[model samples]
Target: MKDEAFDPVRKLVAPGTTVIWRNTGSADHVVDSVQFHDTADQWQFRTQTLRSGDSVVYAFDQEGIYEYYCGLQGEEMCGVILVGDVSLSNSLPCE
Candidate 1:
């Protein structure tokens, strides 16, 4: 992760794979699932503020699109994770 954005901005992973977000910037950051907007109490993925060198890991158990953003940076620092079949290579197009 950079100071203002995630390195790839988009990622594709197989179901049950573990995803890790490492904070490589000088500031603090947070990872919040976008699908939990209305049901604030039911968020499946949320991370505590992570300073430089800190990291968070999450395992994607279902096949679907997961959207997330840095709670501190809002839209300026966001990314998408697509959990699907592992047979498809990383170069495969999204959608």
Candidate 2:
């Protein structure tokens, strides 16, 4: 994830899968799990400000849609993770 974009922007994964975001930009950034209209209190998770080369990982243990964005950039830098029924083998469909 960067200042104004998330690579791939959207992802689909199995429950219990772990996702990672690596900061490659010069500025700081954050991964916030909340929609644009919701209050800060409604967010499920938020990462600390990540400087260049920093990385964050999260596990999706439930089936549903997870909306996330860079709190600093708001809607301009956002993404979604779609967690659905998948094999326990933990391999992504593309693999």
Write one digit per residue (lDDT tens) for candidate 1, span 14-48: 88999999999898899887742332213367899
Quote the lDDT for 71 in model 2.
81
Q: List the residue pairs that clash in candidate 2.
A: none
Measured against the true structure, the TM-scores of the candidates, in listed sequence, are 0.78, 0.77
Candidate 1 wrong stretches, greater than 4 Å? 36-43, 85-95
For the record, the alpha-carbon RMSD of candidate 1 to the native fold, in angstroms, is 6.2
Poorest 10 consecutive residues of model 2 by lDDT?
86-95
Distance from true position, residue 37, model 1, in Å?
Answer: 12
lDDT of 2 at 28: 88
Candidate 1: C-alpha lDDT? 0.72
Cα lDDT tens digits, model 2, 7-44, are: 86768898899999999888789988874332212348
The collision pairs in model 1 are none
